[model samples]
Target chain A: MTIYYSEDHEWISVDGNVGTVGITNYAQNALGDIVFVEVPEVGDDFAKGDEVAVVESVKAASEIYSPVGGKITETNGELEDNAALVNSSPDGDGWFFKINISDSGELEGLMDADGYKTFIAGLE
Target chain B: MGAVNNDLLKTPLYSLHEELDGKMVPFAGYLMPVQYPLGVMGEHNHTREKAGLFDVSHMGQVVIKGNNADKWLETLVPGNIIDLKPNRIRYSMFTSEDGGILDDLMITKRENDIFMVVNAACKEQDIAHMRSNLPDHLELAELNNRALVALQGPMAAEVLARFASGADEMDFMSYAEVEICGATCLISRSGYTGEDGHEISIPAQKAIEVCKALLSEQEVEAIGLGARDSLRLEAGLCLYGHDITEDTTPVESALIWSIGKRRREEGGFPGAQIILEQISNGTITRKRVGIIPSGRVPAREGTEILDSADNVIGVITSGGFGPTFGGPVAMGYVDIKNSENGTDVFLKVRKNKLEAKVSATPFVPQRYYRKQK
Candidate 1:
């Protein structure tokens, strides 16, 4: 499994043709308390960089974009009842959706874990 | 984006907020803490359950003195300033000639002068308005050297009583001059949050000392602007720029109660003609109403309000998750016909239309401390 990060602060962990996506820990921290989340339905097709989800914190709402072109396979429905999982575990059980990758080449545009660390470091 | 804006002014407790890991954000031309490590929801819940200390130094504090101060003030606001007893506080607004609200403020009649607190964003204009209209004998002076802070919640009275004698005994909307941390502080048993609290105006030099002492209390925790917003929203308090703006009238905003009965009959304030006409004829086209979204989705400010047929009827002015209410709570202006309690409204949040209902507010029952007879 390989984890890639988007400039928008979304993270995708790719394994085979499937990739699990969620916001990074840094993104969750900046968003304050998670109150509501609107996830994409399963089997919804999206192109790279399309807005696929929305995360609403106490302050404001933020959009989550598709890291790469893909069709959503599953969504973390647990968020509908308890959105704080995104704040407690942004990378693990807090995952937003699973996408079946449409193009392996699109993953090249995202940053590796090491590169993402550097990118986030510069943000501070 | 993490870098602080050098142009923004810093309050006296800025360094203390930084040391406490507060996330500083630009607000009303000042570098104010939006939240601390506890986050907005936690801070809001803590404030409701225990007590939370807030640094409100950014708000504008001013003193009005000299001859006929109350009479002069009565000309600007619709509240009955003449009848307001010394040490009593009254919520009022400066209305425009056209019945639009200029700004909402707290007026405390002191021994020899009237102390007023206005919104930070509208302070300059409010001061200029008062100054330009002042008579030769009247004086309006801004309290530039004071830092205002609020200790709010159910435990607030107990925590404050430890530092200042007679703190807990003060009635709601009453004021007193008390010595806290060796400084003469103007303490008022009033706050935007629905919970029992006191807003203390301390000398700028003694702000940190007083705040530190308050935070040392077992029941008190440092809260930030984020929680303050949610707390006030749940309290059914209006935010100046959002819920009540220059374009909104007090009658339309459902703040008609703040206007004294005498003022309603004898019109004399800026917008007397227009506001009084609206009062007598019930001509307010739009009225503010409390809204509770049926689902978890928050219908944020500017979201269009629609009827069952999808026709736009109103707009949400303030909306967010109410941590204490355990769901989404909002306040907005709707057509008078659709402003009845329990009226169903649809909120256009993005492309999705969320179901919501018009309900009465102080989403959580107000817990203000009022002395019983």
Candidate 2:
């Protein structure tokens, strides 16, 4: 149940071949309020760095990149109506989409919690 | 951080905000609070449902006094300042010789001097403009040491009434000096958010105490510049940098009514000729409306707005997802024909044509509280 983070501030929790994806808490903090989450439809496939989700705040809108190659297995319908759930629980219930990882090897490119903490610290 | 930076611009409540765990951001050359511990969304929703306390201490507060106060200000801007009775506020724009917007500001006629509050980023320039143009007898004093806090939302009056008795009784666009949080201040029943609210101008040192005092109420939380943008946007209120600028005129920006009838007829202020002409003939271009993309994409600033045939009609001046509206909205100058309320439009997001509709402003209905009597 460990979380991995992309440099772009998206996070994924891996279990076997599945990765539960959402923006990091840091991303939510930076984004102010979550007004919209433009999630890809289930079965949509994207390569790493492809625009998978669009997260918006009151002031700005930003693209959420897929940290790894994957086929979207499920999209968080809750975000469609209550995007602020991402601001409240970015790590758990606020997860954006579930993707079946085409290559777990891509996880190597992402960072773990400690690494993500260090990365956020380095940002300061 | 201390009050003075290298350039010495300071928000009156700078240190107070820091003490309250506010995240200070460098905005328009001044260090100001963008949010507090409850966060931007919480703050924004709180203001909508209850009340939000904003440290608008960065805005420039000036006192223009003398027998010719109205006369001098009138010459510089084509607004009816002379008609502003004491305890009333007016939304006016500073105009250039050609009738372009200098900046938008609030002018309140107090018991004594005329209290003027201009945008934080444009404060220095506005003060300079006033000083250069105002007659010598009409003195300008920069009240730089005061804090301006806006208590906005539906419950704003209820929260302020606890401290300032009869605050709820005040009508829209009215002001009165009251004592609260152990400080004397000017309280105005006005706000950028199209809601019932109050903007309190308190002494610098008492800013934090007043904020804390307001926070003592369960309904009040500190909102940052983030929610401030959304609330104002939902109200269709113009932001100086995004919606209005020196190159944009009042008529073109769809704010001709702000030019008081007296000013329009007097025709003595700066840029009166062009403004009056534009008012009569109508500006060829108009600032149109834009709603959120029905698709899962955001149309940001500088995104091109296109007509049905894919011809570029205008550029987005301000576009963002409104938390309250549950979608994105934007404003921009389009051809006059496309400025109608129900115009069909598309926003070009990257390579995709995202569907958008030209909608009326105040996307949310204004809930301002005016006295029944």
Candidate 3:
């Protein structure tokens, strides 16, 4: 599986046509403590840059944008009870949803691991 | 964010906040920390369970002296300043001519002078207002050489007693001069968090030393404005700008308790006619009340509140996730008819209307320490 990141700080791990999406570690760190996670429902279709989820922190609520065009296949139900997982493990068990890719070409616009590292460094 | 300009003010602990990896933000023309590495939720929970130290030096502190100080102050607010005993603090507000709140503040009556703490953003206006209305005999002096810090929580007194003697003997809303870490400071047994805590005023040059000393204790940790805001919100306290703006009146904001009994009977302060009339006639159109949304989605400021018929009844003034309540708790104004406890309401959150209820304030029960007679 190869992980790709978007400039908006969303990350997606791709395996075949299925891609699991979540926010990057940098995004969670900047968001502080995650109190609520509004995940996209299964079968919800979204294009790149579409607001698909909401993550509410103690200070403010922020929207999580979709990194690529796809239909949500499954959402991580554990987030409803344990939203802090996003802060503890942003890119692993904290995945927000899994999406079935509608078009492989949409993934081309996202950055690879090294490119994302440079992108985040530029933010500082 | 980085400092927008060189003109912004810096607190005495600015470097210490930076060293602790605090995310600095510009607030009320001062570069201050909004959150540190512990995060807002962590800081908030820590404050409820242990203790949190907040750098509130940005707030304006002023001392009023002279024989006519109490009489001069009565012209500004509706609180009973003349009857306030020495070393006791009273929560009050500066009122406008039209019965609106100019700014809320804490007034401490000392034996020789009156000490006042006002909001940072309104400090200039407050000073100008007081100066223009001052009787020549009364002198108002701003304490620019002092830094204020609030140590709050259930464990606050225990940690504070370690440094300042006689801290444990102070009841809620009491003030005294105490020695802490070799510095003589003015300490008040009061805080905005609705918890047993104290606000200490120290010399600006020695602020860092005092703060470092307190933070070295096991129960104390440095908190930021973000957690301070959440804690105050959970405590059902008003945020000066957001909750009690100049457009809102004290009676309408549900702060009628702050008005003294004598002031309510024979009123002479600004807007006394309107406030006194509202108190007796039951003519207040709206009232501020606590709001509890039924879901996890935090209803934030500006969220519209609706009645059962879908009519916009009011708007949220302060709303957020309460760390102790483990749910979304908010405070907002509603139509006076709909402001009763347990009244069902709806919050328009994005595309959905979430169910909410009007509840009694201090979403979590206040843990203030009251003296047992």
TM-score for every candidate vs. truth? 0.99, 0.89, 0.98
Off by over 4 Å in 3: B1-5
**Candidate 1 residues B1-373, lDDT tens each?**
4355888989989889999999999999999999999999999999999999999999999999998899999999999999999999999999999999999999999989999999999999999999888786887899999999999999998889898878999999999999998999999999988999899999999999999999998898999999999999999999999999888889999999999999998888998998999888999989999999999999899999999999999999999999999999999999999999999999999989989999999899999999986
TM-score (C-alpha) between model 2 and the true structure: 0.89
- Number of the top candidate by TM-score? 1
The alpha-carbon deviation from the true structure for residue B76 of candidate 1, after best TM-score superposition, in angstroms, is 0.4
Q: Please write out the lDDT profile of model 1 over residues A1-124, one tens digit for every residue.
A: 9999999999999999999999999999999899999999899999999999999999998999999999999999899999999999999989999999999899999999899999999989
Best-to-worst lDDT order? 1, 3, 2
Clashing pairs in 2: none
Q: Which stretches of candidate 1 lie over 4 Å from their true place?
A: B1-4
DockQ per candidate, 2 decimals: 0.89, 0.50, 0.90
Instruction: For residues A1-124, write the lDDT of model 2, one tens digit per residue.
Output: 6678999999998888999999888888887777777788899899999999887776677889999898999999998778889988998779999999999889998998899999999887
Q: Tens-digit lDDT track for model 2 on B139-206?
A: 89988778898999998998899999999999898989999977998898998877789999999888
Model 1, position B132, has a per-residue lDDT of 87
Give the TM-score (vs. native) of candidate 1.
0.99
Fraction of the real A/B interface contacts present in each candidate? 0.79, 0.62, 0.96
